[model samples]
Target: MKKSVKILLIVLAIIAVIAFPIIGTYNNLVSLEQKVDAAQSNIDTQLQRRSDLIPNLVSTVKGYATQEKDIFTDIANARSKLAGASNVSDQATADGELSNALSRLLVVVEKYPDLKSNENFKDLSIQLEGTENRIAIARQDYNTAVTNYNTKRRRFPSNIVSSLLGFEEKPLYKASAGAQEVPKVDFTK
Candidate 1:
């Protein structure tokens, strides 16, 4: 081949190589975004499972602990807020509210020894605890995805594709204000 033709072929090859990295970066970003979505879905599944358990819990508690309107109302309201949450921040806030409400409800339940020992309530509580653990794990997975995406979007080559695609940083799950406090569990009378 002529010298000019060979030079043109080399230039085309270089352009293709350059294009490959950008394409790969874009694909990686999309995959990372999907992982984040999947993690969020797992968290939601746990939250929904916990939510479904509440009605039975509330009904059981009411049968044993009559006139505890405030605690029940708080739990219902928190559930409503959680159901209505629109974003991660909203969900987090609602989760905190629910946690606080559940904590209060349990504290009040401690007064009723019969209720505490009731097999159904105890079973529900155990299940709720397991769901909470699942939620924590799911949240951690989501945060990991967010961190990975954010790191890529802020770094050199991937940053270019991330910027082009308008990828934004995602928020991580955080402990609520009340959650950070040490429990004042005074079991001894």
Candidate 2:
């Protein structure tokens, strides 16, 4: 080959070598990001399922414990907050609050044995519990995706591509500060 041809061939080969891996990395990042988004949507779906069940549970309780207005109000407020949450952090915090409120509502149920034994209440409680489990699994999946993406984006040559392409870090689903403390349930009222 002539000198000019040899130089041009070398330049093209170098560009191909660098471009292929970057393209692969970019595609991987996009796939991982989509996984994270889908996991997040799953969490929201479960949360909404739980929220939909709450009104029925509350109404069933209302029939027996008409005087327990405060607990019902707390549940309503928590549900509203959860519904209004736009991001992962806000959702986590609101979720924790809703969990606490549900705990308090359950405690109120303990006061009325009839409510606990009622078929509708029992069914709603079971459904709520299952939804909670689904939410937990979804959060776990989201965090796993985030970890994988973040690790890849922060590593060797991929990091350079990630930064150049503006791939930002995804937030994990974390419990709020109050989540550590058990919700207080007082029987004497």
Candidate 3:
């Protein structure tokens, strides 16, 4: 082999050795980021399913508790806010509000034995409960994905590749303030 040709081959081999690992790191980051995105979409899907069930549940309750206008209005407003939420933080806050409203509505339902016994109300309640469970699972999956992606992007070698490739850390879905407090339902009014 000629001397220049051997030098050229050595240089090319060195470039490949360095480039391959960087390319692999970039692809892994892309895959992790995609998992986070998919998890987020799953949460959205479950939330939408719960949202769709709300109106039917509300209507069934309305038939039995026509005098409880304020509770219904609160639920409607909360549902609207949840539907309008555009991001993780906004969705968390809105979800908390809706949960509070739903709790109050459930409290009011206790006053109407007939509404509780109605088939439509019972079915809707069961479906809503299932949907809430799904949402919780989805949130867990999303946070796990975010944690994996963030940890990978922050690690030593991957950190260099991530920063160079503009892979920003993803935010985990957190509960809103006051989420742990039980909603107050005033029955005296």
Best by TM-score: 3
Provide the lowest-lDDT 10-residue window in model 3: 95-104
Q: Which ten residues in a row have the lowest lDDT in candidate 2?
A: 180-189
Q: How well does model 2 score by local distance difference test?
A: 0.91
Estimated TM-score for each candidate: 0.90, 0.95, 0.96
Best of the two (2, 3) by lDDT: 3
Reference-based lDDT, residue 111, model 2 = 84
Count of backbone collisions within predicted model 3: 0
- Rank ordering of all candidates by TM-score, starting from the highest: 3, 2, 1
Residue ranges of candidate 1 with Cα displaced over 4 Å = 181-189
Better of 2 and 3 by TM-score: 3
Q: 1-189, model 1: which lDDT tens digit per residue?
A: 699999999999999999999999989888998999999999899999999998988898999777677778989999999999999988988988888778777886888899998999999999988998998999999999989988888999888788878988878877666766543423333
Cα lDDT tens digits for candidate 2, 20-80: 9999999999998898889889999989999999999999999998887878888999999
Candidate 3 C-alpha lDDT tens digits along 1-189: 699999999999999999999999999999999999999999999989988999999999999988888989998898898889989989988988888888889999999999999999999999999998999999999999999999999998999999999999898998889999999988877
Can you give the lDDT of residue 132 in candidate 3?
88
Choose 1 or 2, whichever is better by lDDT.
2
Error of 2 at 25 (Å): 0.8
